[model samples]
Target: MASIDSKVNLSTIPLVALNVTVRKKLGLYLNPKNIMGFSYLEITNFENFKNPTNEILKNWQAQRSEASVGKLLSILTEAERTDVVEDLRALIDEDVRKYIAFMEKKEDPPVQVPEVDSCVPRTPETLGLTVLDDPDGLYPERFDAFICYCQSDFPFVHEMIRELEQTDYKLKLCVFDRDVLPGSCVWTITSELIEKRCKRMVAVVSDEYLESDACDFQTKFALSLCPGARSKRLIPVIYKPMTKSFPSILRFLTVCDFTRPCTQSWFWVRLAKALSLP
Candidate 1:
């Protein structure tokens, strides 16, 4: 167990059944906002060299992925949560060491781009879109599909969108926090886009998205549209194979696997097929 002041060490304390108060006493400070659906009591025993319980192993395996572990570490690093990061690295499996190293290598130094000060503020008006504050969410035009994803999946989504754009797909992508205009009510815009205007929802499924409240909400809402996975409208692109126990919502859905090497043409072919793009 890692010690804080030689007074409270994690080794002596059993993490398996500790509540938030007990975890706080043990110096484990997990952000409540970030760990919304998680029960802190399910921690793996790190003192003894024995294999963890199946439930603990399952949870840990979920956290082992690029989206889960990687995203958490990135958030911690941004927030300067070094203590938690160090303790977590120590507690994690050996396979995670490489992932952490990869994350470190991927970290780019911040570029000092010059900011241009503009008197005119940017808004939906600039984009020629009328901002209607409709509680019932009545939108005029409908898109072919709305993308439900995490920011970490942006690069892949961007590339996929670019590829689709090159062809005759003319996909109108509704990626929140990116495609949406600034200063608009996020909830309102999201409801309008996904619920009202979008004919289909394309989920870029990964551990990060699965853990996110916003992404999960979008997925469930889309799932409600179709009775099951057979709905061609609700498409799932497997950005990464989840180690976590499969969510009931996506269990029966056919996914386009983009988990393999991107250099291969198969991903594009399969994706085009999934989207029904000629």
Candidate 2:
């Protein structure tokens, strides 16, 4: 680094010459352990290199001299250069460090993305988190939710899921978290499950729900299935603040229009109470 830092790419030949020397010197220590000469072994050992290799490689490759990223960082005032490699050696050193760490962590079983705390960011596979197998390898034991709403109503339905989990309603409520990976592949499985085995349906209604494909499918499914053995199982929760009026079909069920209640503190209590009763 000291030998090549100032002259890096003032001439490419000097930079290449410096890297060859560094790589060879690095190989002397690395080669002995693997029984090959001139092998570039990382000083901190492989175990330390486990988890972050690809990310580091990505960062390193992103900073190589040919890239605009390197040029941009080079021009920055010292104080402003926060997320940059600074120079090629620093980038290489970072990659070597990450590579070593990744090797070290490699055998520890891939770290799973932590279980999402609330179902706000839930997916069919993620919500169906446990790796239990069906003969079909589809359904997990506990993820039975039917998310019913218009595409237009997902904004409110998005907020409603957060509020639902605050209660001990016990059922796994799935209002697709808009903030998670939007447009994820998991929706295909969710679409299948809702079409097949869902019992409880939470419909976030606006006039849009009455007009939309998602609403038409879910509500018609609910109205047809939610009777006799099913009883009054469909919960039509209103989202629009402008209107309290419901369509003649939906007017019969007890409803909570989020219009005023969503703004008040007691709304949570009332909402909790309503959810608690049925």
Candidate 3:
């Protein structure tokens, strides 16, 4: 039996990870927000680990130190704790590698005395895009995140939009559906509109979603637009059981599953964290 002090300590896990078998056997009662979701920890780490680089492994070690694994395990069952911890460690490793890469690029010598060519006619507007960026969201202009999916997947997209909207994440999700453009413009304007807008995209993976080429392209474009093209920015919401495999591009993202509600509450808590909401 876990005591109040134990519960408090478990709940205080720096990173959110719930043990399934432990919860089943011990009847752990955690705040609903702390539920777990599919993460990039395993998939991402496996992708990077295969290459076996000293620097990558070192970065993983650093991120692991940021969170307490033992405290994390004490909160869940043996099995759950082990699985979650291992996965979390993998993701931390990937992040560390990315950080190192970024720093290295920053430290590299700057090219000088190089002649620059202007291919196309440029104006202040083109230059203004990079002008003093606001820390707060783009002031009724740009978005920090954008949820994009096929029109067929509107319901799922809508639900996710609603959930995110309720949180404090400072981004406007341009959810495109029949509702956005009801009439004749639906077919003619969808592709142009979706591609032109949306900075970060969330692809809702479903049976119907894969069946459409339009959707495939949209997800692809969104993935391309992602900064550094890291996996987390473009989300994949797994709506059902699947044998499908994502490309290396998307392999690193945390898959948000709607399959098991009971086990999925912690994912929402991470979403809350991503949203930067209390």
Candidate 4:
């Protein structure tokens, strides 16, 4: 294996790993017109360029020379690009893990790995966070809910999975991206999961959800299984602020709203209780 640099600049790693699609997304969110305090001319120039993503990233690096990967991740998270943030986080974690393994095998004294942020540690022992996976393979057959969400709201969905499935809630979720088998009819499989496989359906409500035809179908189908939410089968979670009114069909059903600051503390706990098996 090639020698690993002990004093690696963690900031550059994610920028280097970012694919074209992710870069484009970031470029849109980080554009000066979208975000305040950025030079209008500079961002406008980058936007008109053929490779705007690279130029935007380069500008960001120049502006915040000391900023770490965590800063970039935060920006992505704030921009509601949690999917990208999660991907970059995984990449960073894997890179750190590889570096740690390499250091362990060396005869030299333990090299101090630079800290990425408060969440990621400087030491090897603390950094080895347990992977959240079903080791015994028992939970595969059972799922608490089939999470209905659009691609844009996946960050909130990702956080929901972490809190509900990975934590003490211990509830299994049927997420299309993670659980759906390949080479199948999407509509057919989705209908089957909502109707039979999962005990409940979690509709991650947002402006995006309101616009998605698939989400509309899933919500309606789940409601059909249990009219008037008699068994509390469909849970609509208000994940983001919306200009559009709540779905008229689901207006009668109680919603778990995460947008409110008061609910943020107990949002997961409340959601877990609702998802728990009877």
Candidate 5:
């Protein structure tokens, strides 16, 4: 069997090998808004293209030809689109997989991965907080917050999970993709989670979020729980800048503006503080 180079660029792969639907989905997922870090093919650099996937591939070949297929796979995995990642992996040639496996063994132990932001507190001590003793309390809440977001903004939601749940903050968030049980009604499950299970609600604000009827429903339901914004249970986080006017309902409430560079350094801390508050 001919050995494949571990460093083979994604651009060199035949388009026929990349399914059309998969290619289109990749193009969407690889957009700068969805992906964090420098390794991705920046779709913004290309303009006036009828077929974005083709253009993205062409540009990747011309400029970032050194980027490996493994890097592409890594990006999709980071985006938390495991289904898409699996589909892409299935399309990889057997020789390429063997080469990747070989390289994985030959490579040195991985370096300590850096936190997403140096400014964000990695431990509860750094944030001057202790883990909530929810179980011991009367009428203990099951979750810190129920994350309300559009499907398009899930990458940001994934980041939220990392900062809140995965870190020392150890906050349990009820996210639709992860928490909702299968074969259950989404509306019923979401309502129960928002009203009963979660103490607070986080509305991930973006252009796509504004258009989503499901997000609207979630936000409204959360608001009804705490009428007149008296409890501050609803937290609106603006991850992406919106072209449309901000929702009238959320306008009066304080927002965690992640879009602003000045606010980003303290965004997670602020959110964590808000969720932890009684």
Candidate 6:
């Protein structure tokens, strides 16, 4: 039987530099059983490099430095590097984070109906006269209403949807906070779901809504569907007092005023009637 030699020239070899012969001979770098001449073999102990915990993984993902990631990669073995890189990539991908944010924000409950149906009959006559007349049927209505509002006005929109649902008519609303799915592109969702499908666009008008780029985008897109000032496709609901700062395009449209306590019922009735719900 032939025995293999595992001797190394210590004078020239540095502990950090794992020469081919050393790597091949000691595949297991820090085996306690191996009486390798190096006294500080513990320094290269592979066990010391255990997989990071969820917290540490999150921290690494949060860091935006490519150089730092490269430094982390260089220290680990090829196999370990692959796993770490994958985990980090999954943790830090922009779309993945967006998906997570979408999921967290989209917690509103879906509309529910009572066990016994409401007596109010669903008929075309119940819908207001100002509602859009779809004679040509150019665009199939995807949602009862597409809600456009700022995050600040989300509470109002949320409550509004709840109120609308309780009425005889069940309003199918595309409220971004509740409608947009995880991993979906928000812009694409807006274009497909709100711009194309919704019969009416409901703008929760407020100072914040006007200030928000997203809210403005939805409002303008909805307006683009109906060019003239008399178009009933776009409905404005006054969530806050924005009379002074109201945009010109929205100024002409008949608005449902929920800003005043006295007009709150009127606003609800107006919106419900516009949606064809008795």
For 28-89, candidate 3 gives per-residue lDDT tens digits of 23322132222446434323321222212223333454433344454444435555444344
Error of 4 at 215 (Å): 0.3
Which 10 residues in a row give candidate 3 its minimum summed lDDT? 130-139
Candidate lDDT scores, in order, read 0.54, 0.45, 0.45, 0.67, 0.67, 0.53
Per-residue lDDT of model 6, residues 50-140, tens digit only: 2112112222323323323224334443435454444433322332334334445557634764555444422333221111212122212
Count of residue pairs whose backbone atoms collide, per candidate: 1, 14, 7, 0, 0, 1
| Residue pairs that clash (backbone atoms under 3 angstroms), model 3 | 22-77, 34-266, 35-265, 35-266, 35-267, 36-266, 60-93
Residue-level lDDT tens digits of model 2 in 3-27: 3344333222212222233334333
lDDT (Cα) of model 4 = 0.67
Clash pairs (backbone) in predicted model 4: none
Task: Score residue 168 of candidate 5 by CA lDDT.
Answer: 62
Compared with the true structure, what per-residue lDDT tens digits does model 4 show for residues 140-171? Answer: 23467999999999998889878876666667
Candidate 5 lDDT over 228-254, as tens digits, reads: 899999999998878999999998899
Q: Model 1, residue 271: what's the lDDT? A: 58
Backbone clashes in candidate 5 total 0
Model 1 per-residue lDDT tens digits across residues 112-163:
6366555432334332222212111111334567888888888988887776
Better by lDDT, candidate 6 or 5: 5
Error in Å for residue 73 of model 6 = 56
- For candidate 1, the lDDT comes to 0.54
Which TM-score value belongs to model 2? 0.40
TM-score of 6: 0.47
List residue ranges in candidate 1 displaced over 4 A: 1-141, 260-264, 276-278
